[model samples]
Target: MRKKTPLNKQIYLSDHYTGNIAKTFQREKDINILQWDFSVEASLVVKLQIESLLNYIVKNVKSKDERRCKYLLPLQYLFRYVKKNNITDILKMEIRQEKEYELFVPKEVKKNSGSLRKFIEFCRRILFISNKEIDWSANVWYVEGLHINPKRVSQGTPILSFSFLDITNSDNRKALQEYVNYLICVTSMKMNTIRIRQTYARDFFRYLEQCNLCIFDVDYQITVKYMKKLGTQNLKSQSYNIKLNAILEVIQYLQTRNYIARFEIPVLYHKEKEIHTVNDIYNIDEKLDILQKYLYLFPETLRIMCLVLINTGVEKGKMFLFRDTDFYWEEGTSWLRIPGENRSIPIPSILYWIIIQYMKRNKLTFDAQLFHNERGKKYSTASFADAVSKQCSKLGILDGEYIFKGSMYQRELCRVLYRSGTSLQAIREYMGYSTEEVVKDIVGWKDEKVAIKTQEFFEDEKHNLGGKLLMAKHDKMKEINQLESLHKVDFALQEIKNYKDSGRIISVTELSRKTGLSKGFFYKNDRVREALDEVKNEQKEEQLGIIRKEIIDYSLEKQLEVYKRELEKTKQENQLLKRENEKLKKALDKQTLQYLKLLAET
Candidate 1:
């Protein structure tokens, strides 16, 4: 400035040297030379000038230390300037790379490798720097100064994985297994049903593991995938949907534990169209026949149990509750009284006779159970199912894998009944269904035949005859409508005339007000005209009544005259009969005297 130095060179030297001098001088300086104040417009001009000066210093300063000094100079100058101007100041500065700034950690950090890798990747992406250029030793300084808690962030993925493993290993999983076993043993549920529950649980755990989340992370996508997988098995919609409910139960369990945050499982898609056909029943019957043969030859009570199931369609648990006393023969009806619900079903006469015959042939007492094993004890449900399966295999009826227990057998029976032309209402009653719709679902029957028959009934020749009779009646009624109206009008008119004769002019308004007739009556004057006609009708009816009375009286006189004539004729006949009787009696008496004389002579 003393020699009129170039503005760029002078500003650059001032910026670069001041930072160095400040660092070297420390707190020994009593006077401050860096402070400067400028006017508002001048201040803006100076800021731009300082920015230019810093850029020049940055370009010109070659050494690493010099460049760092150049970077710090603008901040120091701005601080001094703010103090001189009494301006509120905020620091806006970019850090220069220093040798000490680096992330230092072993390349093979065993404990938190995944987290460390992720952190490195995060720095590369967020700071837009190459991995090689990033220092690995820096602990306090971050390039972007972003304070990411490594311990917190790094714990998520591993902890989530461990949580999933823990659940799979826990007693809850054991409980689920126990539940499956119970379903198989006690509930008469199929292996397929158990398999469905297992698969759902496995998939749920897998989903949690893969997503690095708990069961709470399950979403629509995960559920959809599970459904799609089930769909691939080509299961019937109803069967598939029933299995889906088991899966939902597992999800509900997780939700109850607070492990699952959301719940929106899809409901079974019920198809209104009937999918079962006549062939399905035939197949079921064939299976039943095989099972029957096996039970017969094996001499096991389970066979009789299976036969009972096929015959009665009772659930497994309910069947197990049967006792010797549950069966009774009364009034030609052989019935089984179920426990709990206290419902009873009359066995088919044929089945009833068969059971009676079997009991008699086996020398079993009337009070003895119809189904008992060699052990003389009721078979458990599982043992019963196994016996049925063994018998079915022996009979060579292997069309499809059959579950010995569960609603499948009952549903199959329903299908058979439906195919056999059983009415839905009758089926519902027989099956103890709460609603007809449930029977329809179990049977998978369509009401198309009923619908068509209904439509035909309404459109048949009989309906046409009824329609014609109704139409004829309607026409006759229409013919009497005018007469009926005239009669009503005449009555009203007579009343109006009486009113007029009494010096009370019944205006339309007054008539309406008194009779509560509508305004339309005034518009057409129909009421007034009808009233006039009513008077004529009344006079005519009076005259007709007098004539009718006279005719009746004449008829009654004629009837009396005819009665008198008949009475005289009757009296003449009676006199003739009396004369004949006297003549006959005289002849009888003479004959009797002669007979008496002859008797005396004998």
Candidate 2:
């Protein structure tokens, strides 16, 4: 009979490893070891794999839960069952086969076998191949494995998978690796962006494999076929555009680097299916009201987060990056500083009060994360969004009616600010955007409202003015008949020219006083009125012309100053050159005189 292996000996219990998760890891080991059975050499092998997985979880898993030791259960059960049945080989077991899994795995441990399968997958991806520093040829590549930080996130790190590449097509896989590395090292693209681009590229690679082609074989026809395939997937217009653009960017990169021949991919623009009617505008207001009313029902963290989002329009990714010091009081108003921006936006006093209370309740420090999960880990954007969605759903809010996305709150805030008469420039500054282009889109509906109201106002005023003019017509006719009988046309024309020359205000009253004509005659006589109006316009034009000439003269003066400065610089340079020329000539003359003297002496 074989000697029973000690549990402690079979599994590594290094004190140094205890420093990874400190107390939680040590406690988990103590609790889990009580459940461990006899440890054979096969069990030792399985434990080592489990140790590696645990190390990965400790370092990379976003969850702060302490019960991560459960991942070890499935492997422990497998190795014990194998030893009990006198299995010949531990490593050769077909755990993926349904019959073999059902036979080898116990009923209690079967549920966790999925996690075990993940471990096996992890092994196949990382270990089974050449056990070097980095296996570039592997199907899955981890950002950490390539010695990249990839920026820590509340969500786990990004992993790039190349399994879509055909196994025989190692050349394509290598090219893909080079492209991804270029994105990481040369371009320094955000890891999330790189991951998404890799996903798009992978989908294209998978499509190429189906068509029995490779990346190097891409051309205009392949692009068309790929687009047709994407069309069949029933993707939304914007989503389809993004995927199309991502693939095109990859193809362009491949061509730019001379890996593939240059070819034109058809430039396609996606038309959005969304059309905002008046009803949609009404719906947005209704949703904003609903959000404010039912806000108390949200989870505490999400509630404060949404309030900040609605007020400041901070981006989702930057939402959780806020520190307690990010909020400060300036000019007796509370301000929130945007991360990575030099500016701060004012927040409502009530919102500020709420945030302060929340900070006090949570006992957050100056530099500590203001928003975090229950375990004091920063909450991922996806997790926070899901939480908000779930809460809203519980309150009978449908996704179509009002989703609690961060961007939705942002757009709504922009709409509110614009309607409150905030300028686009101010909005851009408050939102920490370099341009107002996106803000214009969010607040664009207000322009339509303004235009409609203005047209209605003008239409109403036109009708009222027409009625007033009709009522005053008889008095004007009586005055016009009197003026025609008096024959004062020449007199009125002379008075108008005098007014123009003296730069006096030309009106009917002034003309009536000078020419002894009725004001109504000046108003009603077409020729006299035309002459008066022309004189007034000419005077205004003369003033404007004087101003224009002044502006032109000032501009010419500026140009002249610039030319004079250049001329002065040129004169200085010429003087320096002349001095040097004179010095050289004197030196040459002196040398000639010395040569002549030397010839005389000879």
- Identify the candidate with maximal lDDT: 2
**Whole-model lDDT values for every prediction:** 0.51, 0.64
Which portions of model 1 show Cα errors greater than 4 Å? 1-303, 348-382, 397-426, 437-602
**Model 1 C-alpha lDDT per residue in residues 106-179, reported as the tens digit of each score:** 23332323343333233323232222343222221232332222322221011111011223333343434444
Residue clash pairs of candidate 2: none
Score residue 51 of candidate 1 by CA lDDT. 39
How much is 102 displaced in model 2, in angstroms?
A: 13
Error of 1 at 242 (Å): 7.7
Return the TM-score for each candidate structure. Answer: 0.33, 0.51
Scored by TM-score, the top model is 2
lDDT of 2: 0.64
Candidate 2: where is the Cα deviation over 4 Å? 1-114, 117-138, 144-168, 212-223, 236-242, 256-282, 329-331, 340-343, 360-368, 372-378, 397-400, 418-424, 436-441, 444-602
Candidate 2's displacement at residue 206, Å, is 1.2
